[model samples]
Target: MRRVSEANGLRIWVDGDLRDEATRVDAVARFQTLLGILRAWRSEAGELRDEQRAGLGEGPVCDEAGNQFLSIGPVRTYTTFGGEIEWFAECTRRGVGMSQHLRNALWLNGRLNRTAADFYMIHEYAGVEFGGSLGIRDKLKLSTNSQGRLTRAANNLSPLEGGRHAKQSGEAGMTLDEQRTYVADLLRRWINLHSAA
Candidate 1:
């Protein structure tokens, strides 16, 4: 399939080898399905943006020291209503740049995908020590056991909690909501530490 056009918030893709009636019908059906899914996703995203705007006023969130950390605004699109937010505390640490992993983890957290958020934190952001001997996980004071639990949860160790494997007896781990809170707090602390550097 190839994209034919995108106009007025709608994208059109055309598939090759549609000379046959059955193939043409199938292609049209598939296109309709894709359009439906896009519409639903867009609607959900818009609702989330509305909720965020209502909860957080139309202004940048500032830290206690009056440093801006996050700012939310509309996405400039010609035909769709969307939102985007920039989140980053001013990094004052010498030779320490703001990591994209941290930014992506924070963004995924806002999307309510705790599993992906935790994966980014554990696999990407936590592995690198920002100019210190301790990695981000260590800086966050996450115990070895806690780190293992988070890794297990993010890597699909328990089927009961969105994991791939069947749930074992007494395989307790932090719930997705709990992980969300924990990761968010850690990211906040990280931002604060960098802000004060």
Candidate 2:
């Protein structure tokens, strides 16, 4: 079989040697089966995307120890979102660069929130080096393509982003919170598998 084209965000493949009517019919049947599977997957992924997006807008979530974090707040100079320059100045005054400050903040957030410290540290460092959350995502998305699946299904999937930048670089692209979520998800799945066993 060979991939022919991308049909409606899904890869369409054509089977080899369609000289006979039986072979043609079988190929059509297989294509239809694949279409059904794709449709089902699309539906499920759509639902999951909705849920994930909704979760993103949620209020400050508390950790297992009832410690709240992950929200922007007022600072002496400005609000959390507006205090970028002020924060930079403060960090500089404290003999810490912006990158180091971000690492410290992310690490503190991770520890207080009972999250993955290493993932947050890496993600924040990458974000500082790049630009913003989108930059982090662009850099970390490469992890998904490590195996290099040349299919629309893999391309259109979550975390893939299907952008040209994802191809330009091979960095571990992920946002700080996304990295923590990814780490937690891995541990969760591992526990589930182990618990069932």
Candidate 3:
């Protein structure tokens, strides 16, 4: 628990986890008192700004296009007392449907960056179920070989020659150019969804 004296002569009390009954009741009473004080104070709505409401160090984010894109902060990973990994965030927003889209994008990016298992899973699903296109099943198979090994050899040797290798390997059913076009379309759609007004 923590308490501080505000410049306006208001006592600010921040209580930690209130386990005991007494602490809980006292915290509730303190919150009620604070609420009453705030309600009693009258202020002009115009005096408040969006940045102020968003608190300190919060504002518009920039994307690759250098546009002011609204984004939820990156997801935070923490280890709990029980030795389990978890994520936590307290998100507040002003724009319509902002939180939903921002959160979805942030969560997806975080999962991809941290684990990448979801990425492989989704890629497999795309190859098997949707044929790698948005909704076109082009008969792309993503399962392992008969020996339960990845069909495509892990060719991290030459990124410049990746397309040729993929074509020669015959693992990726679509040509490199076709794959690039498909990915470009997908990225365009994703950017549109995230940057929609």
Candidate 4:
């Protein structure tokens, strides 16, 4: 049996049979990575509370018992676009009707900004599902390389912003809001296509 305990706002799993030191270290590393991903999602959702911020303190994260933990800081709110209540309701309805995996992919895509890392993550999560024999790109009339070009452009912008790679010398050819719209449309079409299949 595995015993779970919470510390520094993270769940630590203690397994009795797992005695390998390297495996235990790897499991902790993976758990930390997963925690970071969840924290990023929570930040994107703008759900961080003041108390949580206070608990994080000014330096590295430490529990009340003075046990030092991962260097993760408190999530800060970003300027995310807010839509109408009715539109949000419609989106929620559509998401609720989809399969769990598809819904998660779409949700993560929607929460992302117009950064190269965001584009790459989106592609990794939803692209394969819609690509290949599914013909989603063709149905949307997107060029064979449209997704790739967008991802490259986002990654290769000049004077790199937001800690993403910027080795090229041009813009993404679309504004942030435009990119958001395009991704939203793509996800909507995917949902429609999958539902009909």
Can you list the residue pairs that collide in candidate 1?
Answer: none
The C-alpha stretches of model 2 lying farther than 4 A from their native spots are 1-110, 113-117, 120-172
**Model 2 TM-score on a 0 to 1 scale:** 0.21
Model 2 global lDDT (CA atoms, 0 to 1): 0.37
Output the better candidate (1/3) by TM-score. 1
Query: How big is the positional error of residue 151 in model 2, measured in Å on the Cα after superposition?
Result: 22
> What are the lDDT figures for the candidates, one per model?
0.46, 0.37, 0.31, 0.48
Cα RMSDs of all predictions? 15.8, 22.7, 19.5, 10.8
Q: Which candidate comes out best when scored by lDDT? A: 4
Model 2: weakest 10-residue lDDT segment is 38-47
Cand. 1 Cα-lDDT: 0.46
Order of candidate numbers by lDDT, starting with the best: 4, 1, 2, 3
Whose lDDT is higher: candidate 3's or candidate 4's?
A: 4
81, model 3: CA deviation in Å? 45
- Using TM-score, give the best candidate's number: 4
- How many clashes show up per model? 0, 5, 0, 0
State the lDDT of candidate 4 residue by residue for 50-167, as single tens digits.
3234432434566799997655565464432563333433544464366554555544553323344554454455555556423546654556566756565566655343224636
Instruction: Estimate candidate 3's alpha-carbon lDDT, on a 0 to 1 scale.
Output: 0.31
